[model samples]
Target: MDIIDENFSQDFHCLVYDNAPTHLKRTPTAPSAKKMTKNTPPVGKNWLVEVNMYDENGKQIYNSDGSYKKQHVQMSSSGFTEDGTPQSFYFEPGHEREGVFKGMAIILEERGFKGCVGRNGRLAECGDFSQGCVTAGQPDCCCRRMLYNEPDFVNVWPRLEEVANARGFAVLFLPKFHCELNFIEQCWGYAKRVYRTFPLTKKEDEMEKNIITALDSVPLETMRRCDVLDSRFRSL
Candidate 1:
């Protein structure tokens, strides 16, 4: 071709690219539809859901006390009692789970987060979490066909297959270290900063609610950020 290939790097290119994201060459999943089905509207083939919880008081410290004796402190269990109830059941010297699991579960259920595939995914269970936990640990994939308990141990790809039923998202999981994919992470970070700005001595429930409110204040860059309509008119 007699055209300059450097046009892609020109200011004009940047302006065009900035205004609209490059359209995808292909749809990775689903079949083409000529008409809208009663159950199926124009939407993404997958659905996305994510849940995360944080507790600043859930800190831990370890120190060597004597020649070989090491001491460990579970700051989470030692926080306080607001409703006349303890945070966690202390077992051994260095073991404490504080309200971690329960707190996380509540957040997930409250937000209506279901098991689906994305990066670092966990299996979604119908009712009893035993199956979900098993899938989360082993995950139904070619690699590691067995089952386990920890989600970190399983390959999240299998979870992606399980998530196929959801509508409203792509097959890919949340992007790592990417601010655009999961805006909630930034919201949480911002909320944490805002909450820690002033010294606080509030009830546990109140504190949690305050942080959630702060997180909700973030505004999404919708026009440039949300997924655009697919160009179905182009026959491919």
Candidate 2:
């Protein structure tokens, strides 16, 4: 991103990435109901989400021993209510337990969901979330499931997209398991085939030269054809 901004400041670019887990990971502090408690926490105890600590310049802080430093922080906002009012996951400043995490029940109640709290309290999530209530056509079967289905929660962008969008670059993730849709994969294959044709060499410098030569040997016409094929697959 720094190189792009420095060399081509005026050009708009949209980067495409594979749907890998590393690329789709959200920031640790992003809102999530996966581990939220069903009711308010015990007195003097809080349920803050653990997140990596960052320094003044926004870089993650590392401990002297090399692991990342961590701290408990409130989760991000739980989106808005039906009337357009913003919802928060923690009690407001004036409350007695201010800054403490609001468990799933109260959070759902604030979003106008009734029956979230009962004599027995609600379940944090369904028994088998993916194949349970959702598959049974009961989206509101549990507090956590309902929150998970909320538009704001469902639409939260991954960190990569957030950073790219902030810098005026659009980011798109290619569909998972579809290498044919990635034109660069074809170019890499072509380079590898050319690389095998080179004479065997033991010298490091000679090996590097051979690798670069093999890559450069790929024809521009082949790249164009691969791109066209990728576009056709995408259109389908």
Candidate 3:
């Protein structure tokens, strides 16, 4: 009846990476959409979910020379694969990430909690208003379903605690602003580097497939390179 009863230490449960779109070609010089609507990301249903993404205006994807989009993506989250598995989490993003973030109240109704949030909590890759933001301007998308859109963790974190309480979990949030410590950051970097190795068409679908293939090319190698586990990198 435990989500993850692993001991807390340098390594707790499996590393859960945040999710984000890689190398999205957004630009300012490109002809702008009069009013581009935000694509609604799906809502997750799993007990735990980590996301990496931002609501960058699709039109703002170019620079003067078009070399790079100046947007400062945190580059600290993972994305989904073809089969829907996250870079980690050993579960599907739809069921786990959006589901938990929005369904925490429902989940907690079944489980009981045990620890202060943001302290002694389970492992999770945290995202901010970066890619997961759902402002009043956006429509009803499950990814941003933070239960009431309270606009602050204080207003929303308690519901998560309730879910943990229901499930007898101790929500141990990573340290404030401690993305580097989470192994998932390494995974995002891994996926990006792997995707770049290919022709890597800038289109989302093609590039995402390239990434997933790269991820599948060598699971053990990727895991080692990302340091998902404690082991030396094996040579091919």
Best by lDDT: 2
Ranking according to TM-score, highest score first: 2, 3, 1
Per-model tally of clashing residue pairs: 4, 0, 36
TM-score of each: 0.24, 0.88, 0.28
Tens digits of lDDT, candidate 3, 1-236 = 24354444333333232222221222222212112111212443222222222346634444579554443211111333334433321223565443222222221122232221333332121233345533434322222233223222112233344455465554434444556555556667676777677973769988778877876655566655555342222111
lDDT (C-alpha) at residue 163 in model 2: 92
lDDT of 1 at 93: 40
On TM-score, the leading prediction is 2
How far residue 210's Cα lies from its native spot in candidate 1, in Å, is 1.8
Please say which candidate is ahead in TM-score: 1 or 2: 2
The TM-score of predicted model 1 comes to 0.24
Local distance difference test scores for all models: 0.32, 0.86, 0.37
Q: What is the lDDT of candidate 3?
A: 0.37
True-structure Cα RMSD, model 1? 25.6
Better of 1 and 3 by TM-score: 3
